[model samples]
Target: MKNWAVISTWSMSYDGLLKASSMLQNGESAGDAVENLIKKVESYPLYKSVGYGGLPNEDGVVQMDAAFMNGDTLAQGSVAAIENVKHAVSVARKLSLNKTNSFLVGEGATKFAMQNGFEMTNMLTERAKTIWQNKVKEQFKTGLHPYDGHDTVGAVTLDQAESMSAATSTSGLFMKKDGRIGDSPLSGSGFYADSHIGAATATGLGEDIMKGCLSYEIVRRMAKGQSPQDACDTALYPFCEDLKQRYGQVGEISLIALNRKGEWGVATNVEFPFCVANEKQKAQILMANPGKNQKTQIEPISQSWLDDYQKQINAPVE
Candidate 1:
């Protein structure tokens, strides 16, 4: 059996990772596996940071961003602030085949999806709308900042043939500005892949993530002979410290990587949970946090943590 593997950000991506792992095991293309992984997250109603049930902007509109990259050809496609698309990642995958105009934004992206016969839906569910309504009330009464939650579903896949791909999708920060877009749809920052090297993806505060271009940096480090774990740590930790000094305060930043050799690694400043699966290991969710001396400490996720997450996501809106 040829080597195959997949790694994705967040516990929300575990189910998608499982499906993608099966696809990879069946000798599917990396592009297909990565796209399918992201689409699953986009369609899950309980994941508030992505796709159909994503929370809305300050104006109560659920705008989404997504991107797809093909490592062999270094081709990329992206959409930003798009509305009413059932699977934004699918739209991005379709655009990756185009040579020009591959990145679209706002109404243009939405129109392209509609014209291309992609499934169209409101994107916002009643639950999300209710959450947005309550957020609006709270922000109005307390004058608090509404910028919270930008957990993008990012993934990297390596197929049996050694090909690789990277993709990302997110509804962006809840109660964000009407036209705001995050690193989720931006290459280098949100995702990067290369068949000769490796693949990487990032999730966190898009603003800071974009500044570091952590995904591409990790791949570059891997190309220079660093292992996946070292590449992730070397690329992420120093940047966090530098950003704190230069930009004042840093935000939540997390990254996941998979080398062509089927090795995987992750780095994060926050308590991030991610999913991974390869030929030798079953799909599992793991926790990652910053460690001493600029290293990352990773551990198996506890059953209690999983149970609590399930309850939190399924809890009723008040």
Candidate 2:
């Protein structure tokens, strides 16, 4: 292969996977390439909720959360408070490689940063501050997520070359607290990927989604050769109805996956569409949100994406 291809949604733009893959053009481990990609994002302009220019709290301070995981080693690292450190994902990767199994809260994670020689300044970039103050929740009465829109980004890649890994980071709700970490950093919820089985990620509503382990459910379905979309839908459809049936309220979630075969797929509530990377270098975007207030303009990815993904799976290469 030319290097490796990736599929994910937690990077700055829709091209995050493409951009991240570029970091691996030279010979490097998948884990190292991902770490380098995270570091590069720290100074990059597009992803604010990440590194330096993060989204702000209701009180107008920017706090960030980040996490990194490698299925090959099962090593995971994360930093929650982490101010002005630029590369949250890189720091998390360091933590993962260290003696500690995980890192800490705002002050705690910040203290970890300071001890490690990272600067602890306010990430108050002009654009970042503006987004937190004006751009976020601008017209909403509640000042954020008026329609329950989610703001989490994640990536899960098996890579054409080696090892599976996943990473996720987010600013969380537009006007959330300075320390309100979401399910993104937590495994088995927002993001989960494995080398043997599969990788699955959740978006849309973290709290609601956390009420159930969405990622694990999808992986379980994919284990049955159900295809990524079917696995996500089969795992989610029942849970979505169960939540409403048991609680009498509506909620939503989005999920995407890549199996051992380098194929990618995702499913949502039909309202929130996730962008998918097809083998043909094309993107298949889908939205699954459904209800009275639903925005009905989304379209589904073609079935060929799954068929093609499966093409790479040839009887286990005995």
Candidate 3:
């Protein structure tokens, strides 16, 4: 019997994995296991990069994107720039099951969510509002800041039935342009799954991943007989090389992959922590090594930076 396993992009995803473990033990489908995990992550209010409390766009409106892929059928569903829904990943799952529309975006996605009985709620919390306000003030002086480290949350599962499934969800970059869509909802960019080979998901710097279709490339390499680790390493090489040569530092790009044989791997341009869980093993954080030829460490804007920025925002509105 194949050992059932689930993995995700960040440490917080451990909560989701725990829940999915129960479903897998109950003989649930791999797609259901992955989608359930994503839904749980989307509902968490603390993670500011995804679902509720996610950072807003320039207009201070929270929009989310998500994708779901079923490996056995190679069916995909995605939603982009969707607002008011806390569980955007569920909407993506619904779309995949529908099989009529593989993709939906912007107003269309919102409409579909409402028609399909999704709850509409203010996704922006007071904390997110404060961050958005600070970002707007900062952008007025300098152009948009460089990409920060926190990013999309994702999950991939290998089930006892020997199938793979992957899902990803995110509120795109903070203070981004209105209607901007990231790689999260774009198949092959955010995630790819093939039951015969493996599944992969990506996070961070959507633009770079979209350019290379990085997730799909990883799964393809796995199909070519490369181990999950080798595929992840190979797929990240070009991006790492380009960033080092052009900017002298590796920008953010992290990936997680699981092969049909139940082996898993991860690679990143910077140090990233992920979670891995199986029926026989409790979930654990895996600190991934940085990519080859990585030059400089990329740090998130510090607390001091935010404190100073907040002071500027509060300076008597001058």
Question: CA lDDT, every prediction?
Answer: 0.95, 0.63, 0.82
Tens-place lDDT per residue, model 3, 1-318, is: 457888898765767888888788777889889988888877877677898878888799999999999999998999999999978988898899874876999999999999999888999988788877887788788985654524899888999999999999999887777898878888898999999999999998887778779899999999999998888887887777876787676547899999887788788876676888777766775667563363222233345644664564344421
Model 1 C-alpha lDDT per residue in residues 259-310, reported as the tens digit of each score: 9999999999999999999999999999999999999999999999999999
lDDT, candidate 2, at 212:
83
Model 3 bad stretches (over 4 Å): 141-144, 147-150, 243-250, 291-318
Tens-digit lDDT string for candidate 2 (114-213): 7887656666667656655554546555544553325566667655556777776666666675677777777788777677767877766677777888
Greater TM-score among 2 and 3 belongs to: 3
Order by lDDT, highest first: 1, 3, 2
**Model 3 worst lDDT run, 10 consecutive residues:** 292-301
Q: After superposition, how far is residue 301 of candidate 3 from its true place, in Å?
A: 22
The residue ranges of model 2 lying beyond 4 angstroms of the native Cα positions read 2-4, 23-27, 36-48, 99-101, 118-121, 131-149, 270-318
Best-matching candidate per TM-score: 1
